[model samples]
Target: MTSRSSWNTRNSDVAWAKFDPIAYVDHNYRCIQEDDAEILRIVRDHFADHFRTTDTTGPVSGIDVGSGPNLYPALAMLPWCEEITLLEYSPANVRYLEGQVMSYDANWDQFWDVLREHEAYRSLGMGPRDRFCRAVEVKEGDLFDLARHEGR
Candidate 1:
């Protein structure tokens, strides 16, 4: 029988890890869903509006904590960031993200389709693999273990 952590998972992140990153990515992201497309648009638009007037004299760093097998979040920050971090807890997920970042899976192209609809995203004017591989960094880490950062 498979064991599960019994600790109160409601208010905390304490738990045992279990998931198949390959299966998860294939099932959820391999085929672009309506929900995922909507989310990509929402994130893209939100970021577009948020940074519209801000004077970002330099490229900023971005991080997605407990990012799992998802790459859309990191994609949303692609234009504005010089470097991005995908911090995941699962070992399998870390490996998956590493490969995906280095040699970005083609499945994510649909997600980029939505992102490119935005002015900032399209303004990038470069291929996704070149831009993404240049900017993304994958690290194995849990959410609760993070140290305080200056940003919100």
Candidate 2:
């Protein structure tokens, strides 16, 4: 049997072509339906507090290290953040994330629903897409690159 990694690499192009962020969200939501509310609450609270005192006026940026198929954290951080740069080493994962932001089929309503209901996230912006597009960037790289740039 082909390993997951090999399968992903072999079919990266096709997989990415059919990728849908809304479906991705729905899948994950179903998978974690029990924990969704708690997880989002914690994430939203943490970032809201983190960004509260931080300088958001001058292009605040964050790196989502090792972001896999999960975009919850990155999406959660969008409201209080000015820019988010995602770092995923796998080409397949990168392609998946890119598809999430670039070619999501469903309206961002459901995604926004999660964010809007959370206390911290609700205060960040009017909705998901509005918050998402404000200052988000995705790149194919790793955390080491982020650290290297910060050290400079």
Candidate 3:
């Protein structure tokens, strides 16, 4: 099988940076709500049943491979995860995500209110999502670097 690194290197500059979360939510609201909710529920339940109980550690570490502009997986895993590393090869997307995080203002209740309408906020607890946003560490590299660092 070809390694993830090989794929990442080949498509490092793929233009996933153009994705807009708000536009995506507006276009595919129902599917995003339903599919994402189901997937997140399954993941949460699985982790809660297997890893959470099995591991003595309070929180588990996870990685979001090929994390794009949408950080859904990292947000979903926040309830049970301690740290989440978002690996993205595109410098543009990395900068965009960083900008979103940095520009988020607690005083802008209207923006938040509009965002809360999306089921993503409800299914994944708002607090947990915020925690995940803070916990997420965006790294510029391929999967091979991650494997090497983790000693996988």
Pick the winner on TM-score between candidates 1 and 2.
1
- Where does model 3 exceed 4 Å of error? 1-33, 102-126, 150-152
lDDT (Cα atoms) of all candidates against the true structure: 0.83, 0.64, 0.58
lDDT of 1 at 71: 90
Off by over 4 Å in 1: 1-16, 148-152
Score every model by TM-score: 0.85, 0.64, 0.60
Report per-prediction Cα RMSD to one decimal: 3.9, 6.1, 7.2
List the pairs of residues colliding in candidate 1. Answer: none
> Residue 89 in model 2: shift from native, Å?
0.8
In candidate 2, what are the lDDT values of residues 53-152, reduced to their tens digit?
6765666667787676676677777766677877776677777677777544353444546666756766654556656665667787755566667652
Cα displacement (angstroms), candidate 2, residue 138, comes to 1.4
Q: Taking the candidates one at a time, how many backbone clashes does each contain? A: 0, 0, 0
The Cα error of candidate 3 at residue 135, in Å, is 1.3
38-72, model 3: which lDDT tens digit per residue? 66566645655674357465666778887756556
Q: What TM-score does prediction 3 earn?
A: 0.60
User: Candidates ranked by TM-score, best first?
Assistant: 1, 2, 3
Clashes of 3: 0
Residue 100's lDDT in candidate 3 = 50
In terms of lDDT, the poorest run of 10 residues in model 2 is 10-19
**Residue 21 in model 1: lDDT:** 80
